[model samples]
Target: MSRLLLVVLLLANVGTAIGVVYARHLHRQSFIELARLEKTRDELNIEFGRLQLEQATVAESNRIDAIARTRLGMKFPEASDVVVIQP
Candidate 1:
């Protein structure tokens, strides 16, 4: 009876150790995943900042006018080219 009790206690200790190892492994995996997610979030934040800057640049009316006049060679129509059509 004493030998059986000793064997059971040893088995329980071994089981508890295995559980601890498995728990540590899961904790490590979760930490690695959290790190990867944080990296991805940082990349997205950088891209969002870049896109916001691009939107601001594109939304500038003066910039559009400059591009239209200087690069596209657009000009205002002459008075004779304008027809006064009112509803």
Candidate 2:
């Protein structure tokens, strides 16, 4: 009976050790996954900032005016060319 009790205790100890190992492995996997997602989020944020800057540069009035003058041959006329028509 004493030997049987010793065998049961040993089995229980082995089971507990296996549980600890499995839990540790899962914890490590989750930590790695979290780090990967954080890196992706940071990269996306940087890209978003660059896109915002590009939008601002493209939307400037000075840039549009320059393009119109150079590419489309648009010009502001003299005061004498202005005519106001009243209905």
Candidate 3:
């Protein structure tokens, strides 16, 4: 009876060791994946910031108005040139 109890205890210890090793391996893999994902996220964030700056520079309303006034010779009409059109 004593020998049987010893055998059971030994088997339990072996099972526990195997479970601990597997858990450690899983944790290591998860950390590596997390690092890779974080790197990708950072790169995307940089690209997004650059695009935002480019959009602001390209679509400036004040610049468009300046170009229209200086280059196109367009002007706002005076009260005489204003036509009263009603539908």
Q: Go through the candidates in order and give the clash count of each.
A: 0, 0, 0
How high is the lDDT of residue 36 in model 2? 99
State, as a TM-score between 0 and 1, how close model 3 is to the true structure: 0.74
lDDT tens readout by residue for model 1, 2-87? 99999999999999999999999999999999999999999999999999999999989999999999999998899999999899
Q: List the candidate numbers ranked by TM-score, top first.
A: 1, 2, 3
Candidate 3: which pairs clash? none
**Superposed Cα RMSD, model 2:** 2.7
Superposition TM-score, candidate 1 onto the true structure:
0.83
Per-model lDDT: 0.98, 0.99, 0.95
When summed lDDT is taken over every stretch of 10 residues in candidate 3, the lowest stretch is: 58-67
Over 4 Å off, model 1: 84-87
The model with the greatest TM-score is: 1
Question: Which window of 10 residues has the lowest lDDT sum in candidate 1?
Answer: 59-68
Candidate 2: which pairs clash?
Answer: none
In angstroms, give how far residue 28 of model 3 lies from its true place: 0.7
